[model samples]
Target: MSTTERPRILVVGGGYVGLYAAKRIMKKMRYGEATVTVVDPRSYMTYQPFLPEVAAGSISPRHVVVPLRRVLPKAEVLTGRVTTIDQDRKVAVVTPLVGEAYELPFDYLVIALGAVSRTFPIPGLAEQGIGMKGVEEGIGLRNHVLEQLDKAESTTDENVRRKALTFVFVGGGFAGAETIGEVEDMARDAAKYYSTIKREDMRFILVDAADKILPEVGPKLGTWGKEHLESRGIEIYLNTSMDSCVDGHVVLKNGLEVDSNTIVWTAGVKPNPALARYGLPLGPRGHVDTAPTLQVQGTDYIWAAGDNAQVPDVASRKAGVENAWCPPNAQHALRQAKVLGDNVVSGMRGFPQKEYEHSNKGAVAGLGLHKGVAMIVMGKMKIKLKGRLAWYMHRGYHGMAMPTWNRKIRVFADWTLGMFLKREVVALGALETPREEFYEAAKPAPAPAAAAAPAQKAKAS
Candidate 1:
């Protein structure tokens, strides 16, 4: 590394904010003044909003992720994790996917590591619960659900069948609610092909610790959503928590217990703990604290955004709140990234940096294919929508916001083709170990009868 070379800008985590921020910076920078590098464990950026549809077989898992290399052609993309950042030394310890650790010195840094699923030390949760945070998890959940149907159809034991058919979701947020609804709809449709498992035989339960779900949408729509899910035979357990899910047996705090093979955990997420190792200034909740301009406090060269940053919300000023922080969501992440990117260039060029401010646009959630709830805020008025129309709006908004044009077209194509094609419900449970069955069957057996007879004749002669 030459000291006289171009100033290096290192962006950590190739998530929604990292990808877009790097792209925005690269687009703004002129020929070779600074070098931008993005580091993440994955080479693709997952469009997480469509994960529920992917799990439900509405979209191909491949279509829901945007490849970083394709989108950031100008920036050097490194597939790795940043183990630690020495702010005083201005170096990041990066461990590549298949190599030894190396020190990456940077003139500027962007902390966009994002958040991880918040989990508790409950018994059997680590072993039994599944999450819907990534593309692989979405695909696994899809296969697991289909495999449950197969198990229920083939098994003659009533207890085993009952256990296989019951599915429990431990969160009532958008991820949990949308996932359960889509999966339930998929399972119901798949029952048509099964001779033994009927739609009514399967059970879907959604549990949340809060009094209401979809708090991003106001109270009225949230209440409507709870009622809507309950009317469809989906049990809603609000203001309750799961006591234990030991060995696929879920015990709720309300004294309700059930045996379920599939347990999806989407309760919530906390900032990635890896950020703390970087020695940056973090808030009480473990998120990097940033100024209103999206710059890391007390640092002129480092910036942070996305779920990992506590960016103050300037838009909340109308409500008489001062320095209100922004919430961690896709909408905020996307906008914050753009501002952070521009601010980076502004800092580099010695220009005035702009402040970050955006009011809540409300939220929209899809319950299933044609069901949803939305609350859109326009100035002083807040409008609520539900049912099929809201569902269309939900899909339309996310479909357009699905990132790159390549992925946008692919996602829309998946939705378009879904109208004419039948949903695929085949479970490739053995996908992880394709050769296990073959290897077991091909193991050497005892000597065959003909070989044994030949040996015996030779001995007798």
Candidate 2:
């Protein structure tokens, strides 16, 4: 029988869930038992946890992303978006990068659409706010931050220098705190290369509406992280939020205002709104509703697990917690994907499905090169660490957790090389628009006669 004649497993969204789930399903299923198709807008899966390192120039952007086609050679990978799902027809509408939409029939479906950066309608935010949700944004932020230093070092005007030197970051979560910490460390090092710029000349402000930062690491470590950042001459504004960043003039809800050219927004994320079109049962917060078995509620053949699925925390419930849901993090997403993929294969073979259950394994947050906080939880015991030790834990966990030995080795190599080599602080901002220079040099030259005509006309007059 041709490939189309076999049962099809459709996995949507090539993120943490989609990549791992497809890998597991391919490994477990018998040869010729089914065909697996993974569809996503990008051809690679970005390991989001390393985004801060990418932004800080610690890890090469290429190392953090895994090419889908290369890794899943046995499965069919489509670079596109699944626009709609018609459950009644068991068909999904796929719109490729450059083609007409087509219907793909499938016997089983996996929804791992993931989440997008959540934003608000504050004035001028759409124009000035930068996000840290993807690899591109992380790279852009790195260059943008460095370019600000260049602007400050070369400009003579005090106001311009001040505006260029002021960097404002909103949200005190891991993304925000870690980004600011890494960036501040970068800027401090970068300042040594400038004659006029010093660490004191640059201002790093971290603002959040919450009472503390790094809430994932517990309160004690959170407080320690805050105090540590403050000791570095960085400004911390808690219990406050940004009101406006109109034209780079940042105004806060607490009535503080400052002019800054760089404003990063890393508040949080929401489930991909596209989930609405799939006609699946969604939870109160727009996440796909799923049972503990990692299968979508009311649907036997459909499964979802990731940031986009509201899967009950069976482990938490088993520990006597009520209404506990798995938090959307790499720890949970990675584990759930394996279970989800196995369940998919079992369901196909008419076997029993295993319920997904995993308790919190604590959390780790790296503040900068040698600074971090961690909380390790094991069977009713919680151990906390701070400073260099915590930083090592943060790196060690993420390094091993990185998908595939290929990526894990590359990432660890980068860290190892960093130990021997001087920190690379150069900003390749031009990478953002690599063609602009070529276009300037290669565009057709203006006609000499046309250029002279204006002067000739003046002389004639």
User: Which candidate number maximizes TM-score?
Assistant: 2
lDDT for predicted candidate 2 compared with the true structure: 0.94
Per-candidate TM-score against the hidden true structure: 0.95, 0.96
Q: Estimate every model's Cα lDDT from 0 to 1.
A: 0.91, 0.94
Runs of candidate 1 exceeding 4 Å displacement: 1-4, 437-461
The pairs that clash in candidate 2 are none
lDDT tens string, model 1, 285-348?
Answer: 9999999888899989899999999998888975889868898889999999999999999999
Model 2, C-alpha of 198: deviation from truth (Å) = 0.5
Worst 10 residues of 1 by lDDT: 1-10
lDDT of 2 by residue, 67-107 (tens): 99999999999999999999999999999999799989999
lDDT of 2 at 159: 97
Q: Ten consecutive residues with minimal summed lDDT in candidate 2?
A: 1-10
Q: How accurate is candidate 1 locally (lDDT)?
A: 0.91
